[model samples]
Target: MRFIAAFAVFLFHLTMLSIHTPHGIDVLHQFKDEGVREAYNSVFHIAGFTGVSFFFALSGFVLTWSARSTDTLTGFWRRRFFKIYPLHIVTYAAGLLLLTGSAFRASDDLPGVFLLQSWIPDARVIFAANSPSWSISCEALFYVLFPLLLPLIERIPASRLWWWSAAMVAGIFAVATIGHLYVSMEYQFWFTYTLPPLRLMEFVLGIFAARLVILGRWPDIRLAPATVLLVLAYALALQLPQVYAQTAVTIVPVVLLVGAGATADIEGRSRLLRSRTMVWLGEISFAFYMVHLVVLLSARKWLGAEDSYSTPKALLVIAGCLAVTMVLAWLLHIGVERPAMRHWSVRRQDRDRGRTTASV
Candidate 1:
């Protein structure tokens, strides 16, 4: 599921390489006559936005579901820090090295270095170092709050989980309404889409969904129905105004599909996405998402600013980019992410405390 969402986002960016970069304007020129625009407007655009929302919701779900009663706030935060920051730093540095002078700003990128860019309304700040990283900023905020959020969610009566879910869902819409009515067009997308606090609602929704399943309060929605709902929501997103369509329209379906998928795992039902290959891909999907844009943008720079090619060649470019991105992702996962989690994430006190054998 993570791989699917990351790939959807990758495909969406394939059609949206900025016109500002050298020959970047011509990047999609070959697809001018193709269905790129229609495809984006109808589906890929929604996929790109909702793909990100899916990540936020899934983070909430996974963390809440796996949270241990014995874990302390510092331990939880430490593990999460190890999980994300190493890869983030590697990619953040790589992104800085590749960006053009216009795209890279020393002062503006400071916020992004710490994954705090999402709070700022200015695109220059939010998108400064690595544009896609704006979402990571939101995720970091979610991690910081999750320990606090979990206890609050745990106090809710198990039976009222659905109502809590609805409230979070409503909060998403309220964000859209505020962005639409109050924010200027220049910042509305930033306010509604990139703001960490607003996006946190989806994360909170995920937290609630996990508790629902843990408490056996979840409904009997099959994976098929949940998937169908996702498709229908995507279709509906196409007709809605862009402001409301970003994450607001598809939150429920995305969260439902996530919960349903988890429920399937719990029941050991027919699980097509459970293949070993799929699981490995899901494991590295984070690295893939983090590195793909850097890979694409770097490739474009190397291919020359004025390069143009047939749609076939352009797609071949995408394929090559994917190959390179995946290899880099694999290396990062092996060389950085896993090792950090293994070594640095656990404090000496925790390890010493967990040991079973008595020492002299």
Candidate 2:
């Protein structure tokens, strides 16, 4: 499931990279003034966003699965923070340094580099970079809030929890839509795009999925055959008029994958997840996501490649970027995440001993 989600995201980015302004933007611009054309772009615009929603649902399920037992919330947060933050901080600082060196001179789309806004062409013409990491910022906020919110959310009766979860999910999207409309009126694109509250539903949907598993309800989860049918159902749902309606389509496949992972024997599934190749790519997904944009930007400028949207060239760039990002992420995972986790473990053990001694 992790592998599939990772690959889906990679494909999302790959598709996005091919959607360059030089080639596709003209097509987009011709339709900009036309309501039908604009609506079509809006539908396509939501594709990558749908991938992110799937990721959120997956994260919620995975994290809740980890904490299903009456576990110490502090320890849970500590492990999660250590596991995710060190890599993020290191990469973020490095990204900032690269942008500093370039002084936003090479790329007109600077807001993305700093993650101040989405890379919607209009939002791109701004005073920073880190476009790719905006989602990271949203993710970071979710991680922080999850630990605090979970206990309360989980305390709701198992039967009633789904209703609560549904409300929370719906509420988030409702507010985000209203917020987006408000921002549009005021031209607050930065606030509109980066607002953490607007994006919280994706993560909360994930939590709801996890809760379903915890209660053994497994709502919407099914076998591959059933999954196929649901996918058709979800695709039909995409024709609905909501922003990010395609999320309806993605949820079923993700649920099937998660269900598969949960039910599979750990010893057997571990082999699949921990295989030399799958583990390698999973380890590097973080770095691959972060660094691929840099590679694309650098290559476009240095190679003077006019065919930025060419599939062949994009595939080649993906291959090269994946190779390098894998090595780098593995190194960071070992040197940074693994070691920090151990250090936290040692500190926890020490604290436990201290409490025991004081009680004596």
Candidate 3:
């Protein structure tokens, strides 16, 4: 599911590149007929953005699901830092090397390098090298608060978790509404969309949903129905104005879909998402997400912007980039992510040994 979401984001970026034209001369204009363009826009324009939402929610779900009762907050933080930062720093440097002449800005690079770019509302900093990493800033905030947040969440009665979930849903809509009515378009895009604090609500919703599932209180909706709801919500988002669409219009379905997936896993029912291929892809999904934009930007630099490609040529470019990205992602997962986790996530070693002794 995560790999699929990342690929959706990759496709969205490709589409954005293809349509962007400077001086009224789009290179892709020659190949894209009006009908094709309109179809592409209608189907893909907003759908890709939802991938980020999926990720935010999934982070909450997975962290909550795997959290150990005995784990300390510092232990969790250490594991998370080692898990994400090693690859992040490596890819951040890669982005700088590949895009130095173009999108790279020294002033923006400082914040980006430290994963603090999303703290501010500046587009230059928010979208600096490895632009997709803005979400990492938000993730960092969630990690900082997770230790504090989890205790509060655990204190809530199982039966009351659904009410908390409901409140989260209300908060999402409320933020969306307020942003639409009160915030300027510029502030709305940066503050509402990219700010870590605002995005924390989505993460909290994930945590709340996970608590419900842990308590056996999650709704009984099956995976199929939950998935259908997700698709329908995405479709509805397409019809909405850009402001609401870009906000949390589909958050309800997202939370439901995540809850359903967790339910499926706990029930031990086989699902496509658990297949070997998907499992491998999901394992490498984070690396793929980190490196794909750099791959895309490099490809564009070499082959000219995506607008330069004809329809068939663009298809080839997308295919090629996808292949290269997967290869690189696999390498990074093995080379950086795994090794760092093995070496730096040392706090859990005693716990693991204790578990082994008890089981024996």
Candidate 4:
């Protein structure tokens, strides 16, 4: 799920890089046929918005499902730090070195460096470094609140969990609808999509879902229907005036899909996510997410300087970038991400006592 979500965002960015920058690798525009270009654009355009919603909800669900009573708040925070920050540092430095100065400002540098960029309303800051990492900023805030949030969430009675879940979904919808009706696009995107507090609604929804699954209250929402719901939601979001509705509309189905996947796993019903290939990809997906844009951007600087390459060459460049990104992501996972977690994520004393607990 992580890798799939990350890849969706990747495709979305690969296309957007061209639209967003002058010298970007223009694969989408390279296609001469208007129908083909529009088809490609539509799919990739929504991919990031929906992918990010899936990730935010998945974060809450996974953390809640895997959270441990024995874990201290500091311990949990430490593990999450090592899980993300080292890779972030590497990418941040790379961004500084690789991205054009015009693309980012000194004022925006601190937020990117500290993984706090998503708080500010400015898109440049949020997208400064590894552009995909804005979501990580949200995850950072989510991590801080999780230890505090989980206990309160657990206090909700099992029977009303569904109701609370519905409320959360409704709140998401209300915010998006209101933003669509009243706010400017700038504020609308910030308020409905990028704001840490607003995005927390989705995170909390996933927490509710985790509780339902834990209590054996999760509905038997089959995958097919859940997927269709997601597609319908995305289509509807596109029709709406405020584009930020994309995340809000599809969030329910995303959580449902996550719930179904979790239920299936508990029932020993699905082997695909657990397969070695997917498991390996999932392990490195974070690195892939962190480094993919940097790789694609660099490719643009060095190899894709043309306004738009021929379709064949553009495809070749994309494949090449993917290959390099996979290698770099693998290297990051092994070299920085894994070693940091192994050595620094958990306290040695806790590990020695066999008290290290499962974490997201």
For each candidate in turn, the TM-score is: 0.93, 0.69, 0.91, 0.92
Cα displacement (Å) at residue 260, model 4: 0.4
**By lDDT: ranked, best first:** 1, 4, 3, 2
Q: Provide the global lDDT of candidate 2 against the true structure.
A: 0.55
Q: lDDT tens string, model 2, 1-360?
A: 444554444444433332432211122222213454445454454454555565666777778777646556676667776766676566655655654344444454344433433333253333234345666656766777888878877887888866876676567556546644665543443443445565566677677767777677764433455447645644654576444354434554555555555654332544666568876776656655555544444444444434433444445655776666556667776787678777773467777887899999
lDDT of each: 0.83, 0.55, 0.80, 0.81
Measured by TM-score, the strongest candidate is: 1
Alpha-carbon lDDT of model 4 = 0.81
Candidate 2's displacement at residue 122, Å, is 11
Q: Please give the distance, in angstroms, between residue 194's alpha carbon in candidate 3 and its true position after superposition.
A: 0.6
Which candidate gets the maximum lDDT versus the true structure? 1
Model 3: runs farther than 4 Å from truth? 17-31, 102-104, 347-360
Instruction: List residue ranges in candidate 4 displaced over 4 A.
Output: 17-27, 30-34, 101-104, 242-244, 352-360
Task: Sort by TM-score, best first.
Answer: 1, 4, 3, 2
For residues 1-360, write the lDDT of model 1, one tens digit per residue: 899999988876666556422224334443544565455435565667889989999999999999999999998999999999998988888877776445656667778888988898777778665568889999999999999989988999997889888998988999899889999988888889988988899999999989999999888998999989988988898899887779888999999999999999888873678888888999899999998888877787678645666667777887998999999989999999999998889997766866744552
Q: Put down candidate 3 lDDT per residue, 1-360, tens digits, no spaces.
A: 899889988876655543231111122232356666667767887765689988999899889989898988788999999999999999988877876555455687889888899988777678776778889989999999998899888999987887888888787778878888999876777766888998898899899888888888887988889889888888888998765676478888888888988888778764788899999999999999999988877777666543444568667777898999999999999999999998787666776886899999
- Residue 328 miss distance in model 1 (angstroms): 1.0
